[model samples]
Target chain A: MLMNDKVPLIREKALWMRRTAFTMVHRAQLGHPGGDFSAMDILATLYFGVLNFDAKRPDWPDRDRFVMSKGHATGALYSALCAAGYFPEDWLQTYMQPKSLLNGHPNRNYLPGVETNTGPLGHGFPVATGIAIAGQLTGATYRTFVLTGDGEQQEGSNWEAAMVAGHRKLSHLTLIIDRNRLQQGAGTEETSGLDPLDDKYRAFGFDVVEVDGHDHAALLAVLGAAPASKPRCVIANTTKGKGVSFMENVASWHHGVPNAAQYDQAMKELV
Target chain B: MATVTPTAAGLQDCRNAWVATLEQLAEADPRIVAVVNDSVGSSKLNSFQKKFADRLINVGIAEQVMVGVGAGLANGGRIPFVSAASCFITGRALEQVKADLAYANFNVKLVGQSSGVAYGELGATHHSIEDFAWLRPLTNLTVIVPADAWETAEAVKWAAQHDGPVYLRLSRMPVPDLDIPNRTFRPGKAEVVREGSDIAIIACGTTVHLAADAAEVLQAEGIHARVLNFSTINPLDEAALHRAAATGAIVTVEEASIRGGLGGAVAEFTSANQPVPVERVGFPGFLPTGSTDWLFQEYGLSPEGIAAAAHRALKRKA
Candidate 1:
């Protein structure tokens, strides 16, 4: 769990992420708010209390890596990076605008903290597995973390990467699944069932950890833990569109835009 | 049978040179690593695996992960050479190659072994004829098709030293080394094997030597044919192409499909910049069951066939 003094700070960061992300989505009118809200707290916890990174020295060889595998949730990732001081807060205003560095997906070249370009599902896990293998090969002390939507677990490429991470025994790797249960059109269960997700990962030789995704203290508790003998997989159970009451658990908000009234409601509820 | 007779050096597979150069590079730099998709034997990396056991990552028939791992290894400061069969490496994990390596601009080298019709009898699925077309659009990638073992070794050395993404398309088909006096590996530059005024015969990979032999055939017929070993496909040596275009007639040869290999690159360049009668010698599409020799002879990849194509282009020019 997070220290008593840091828990409040992390909680405050998470609230800011929700508000900022919602604002970006409202302005853009073309953002994945449902997925973004579900993943924001996890991003907040990692940037504020868990991950080891220097925005100034972003290319530091020994820096820990956090790959945002669920890339469409740029609202969450951009806000967290901005808060971490990777760039000025004003850059967040251009989120998804033409020629903005904050693309629909995260690009490592354009942005400082993005580990790799990931818009297509199932890409992040394999790239992150590769990063972990690099650490293992050189005996490097840096850790690699990747976050994928539970819905994205259906992509065959993820399983392919899981096997590599397992076969190589990449102990320094951690995979966090934002288990919000909803995909773009429908529930993950209705679309493609991933209920035995934890068991599948365990079968792939990852130590499984299930956590309440929105709870900053619980998130810190599991995310900040040391590496186990096997690679780690954290299934972060969360509600889709968690912060806004009207959008909560609604599938249409997967890429839904908010009108003026709804925007005001979301902004008020985000706090 | 290959058009060229056995030289004093004898027949040598390019994979041998690839592994040898990789071994040397690894010895010099600890950051050099090899990632494969259960292709250690096919890629001729058995010795590499033995020497750098911990560094050789075998992702067990997983091309997507193998490429992604290469990009990841580069991120960790290791220059990774990801090797596999040309067909699988380019087809199976194409998106991974595009996003992780090319689009992301990772410092990785992708070695495509047994390119073209090396697996001739194995049928169309095993042939990597479409690799050029598939990969050509990704401008970030450097596509190098080495002609012989000497060029193969040089290309590997160059890839290791260069700090960007590259695709080294190596053929398993044995080829005699080009008889150039002072050879230097200038990527994106065509090698002039023979000088002539009547026509220019452009070839890459296993067909370069055949183009030279075709030049000899044309020479005996009072048609002095210029032979260019056009190795790099992506960055079309436009300077050399301009010179070739000045000759008024050209014959482009390759072991790949005519749609997008060297033939396609030449056709695209000449049609727009310098309109000339260009004869493209390559496979039209899928091939019937045949050995590499029979396919080469049937598809005009042989010296006589290339010479005939050069004649046809000269006729069109007149």
Candidate 2:
């Protein structure tokens, strides 16, 4: 059983991840706020609870690999990395600044935690497959997890990777779909319905599981469960803009940074 | 140089040379392996698959997965030569090549078969003329175009031994060998096939033999021309180019698009360092369907056409 003492601490860590996400986006004045906020809790659970990585040995071959397939939500990843002590927390303030480590996209060249340079849709899955395949070859127990956005799933490449993952029987790899219903322009159903997403993944030969994305207990339980045989896929059903009162489930916040008043309100709500 | 035997025999495609050399390399070294996008027969890698069954991983027509698997194999301490049709390998998996091979700095060797107009009958849809233009901008990726079977063999051996990202443009067209018997292939160096001071004919891949034949014609006409076999496109031998520029006139030729092929590379070198009368010869724009030979001749990538360009460049030279 998971230590009960760690449960309260995970909530604190997740709240910190949320605050860091808001602060970085507010500082950069440019970020995918909706996706970042929706996925923050999940990222926190992985970094704090599941992932086995040390800031000192960032490139350790045996360490568990994490790829942010929804690379536009790099602000969330940067904040998580900082909270994990990979870098200074103050580094979040330099988001998108000239010569700063934070770019519009996560560059593996500049950042220690980023495994691949991703910004284009459907890019990270294949790369994560590569990392996992490497582990299989080396007989290492390291696991690779990739998180992709609901809109980004429309890219044909993601499906292509999904098919390969199943065909290769990559039980060491896990694909987490941040199934937030809303996209940049409209709700995913209104834009392009992905209602049968769970079935689609199951048909693709993955062992599929559905869970509430925001609930820490459910996310931890589902994410920690090892695959029985085939590669596992967790459909993290989520709201587009989660946590903040007015922004939740809104599509406009996909890339819209909160104004000063909204920022204060968001901070107050988080507190 | 290989002299064609008068005996009636079927010509061997250079891709066969690529696979044969790959198998030979694999037998000698356990690390050498082949990666493909379900293109085992297309890339002439069936012999390799037969010999090393488990090593040939057919990624099932997914170019992006093919590249990623290559990077993964490289990460697993295997020297993977990822083979695929040039159009899909370079076009579909461009970002993967940039990230996994170039950015991640893996030792994955990308082998792009049937480059240029080799897929002539398949129409412009199958052509890979823009491969050089797409790959030249990226750092840590060496691009090489071998002129004939001999060069292709030498290039494959060199790529297997050399540790970094390399792209070998293995063509399907047949040509007489341009290298001396048992000559070692050097990375990032140019080979001066024929010597002349009036004009320098710089070419690569199928065009290297064309450039040599063009120099032969120029010699008969009392217009001497130097033929430079530019096998390595990137990390170009600048000193040799500067020496060629001193000859007053240089004509660059290739089967790729004129905008970013051999001509563009030479022009970029000369414009900044030593400007001279340089004539660029390549596919000028979009082309229609035909056989490889017909397309090459139609686009003036032939010996006679190169000779004419050299003569014109000589006339334009100060």
Best by DockQ: 1
Candidate 2 stretches greater than 4 Å from native: A1-5, B1-12, B24-32, B72-78, B103-106, B161-163, B181-184
What CA root-mean-square deviation does each model show from the true structure? Answer: 2.1, 3.2
DockQ for every model comes to 0.85, 0.42
Our model 2 lands, by Cα RMSD against the true structure, at 3.2
Please list the residue runs of candidate 1 whose C-alpha ends up more than 4 Å from where it truly belongs after superposition: B1-9
The residue pairs in collision within model 1 are none
Model 1 chain B poorest ten-residue lDDT run: B1-10
lDDT (Cα, tens digit) per residue for candidate 2, span A1-271 = 4644455667788788778788888877899888998898889888877788888888777788888989899768998888888888777888999998888888877888887768887778877776666666557788888899988888877887888888878888899999998888898888878879989999999999999998887888888776567888999988877888878988899999988999899999896
Fnat for the candidates in order: 0.77, 0.36
- Compared with the true structure, model 2 gives a TM-score of 0.93
Which pairs clash in model 2? none
Kindly list the per-residue Cα lDDT of model 1 for residues B85-118, writing each as its tens digit.
9999999999998899999999999999888988
lDDT per residue, candidate 2, B186-233, as tens digits? 889998888888888899888888888888888898988888989999
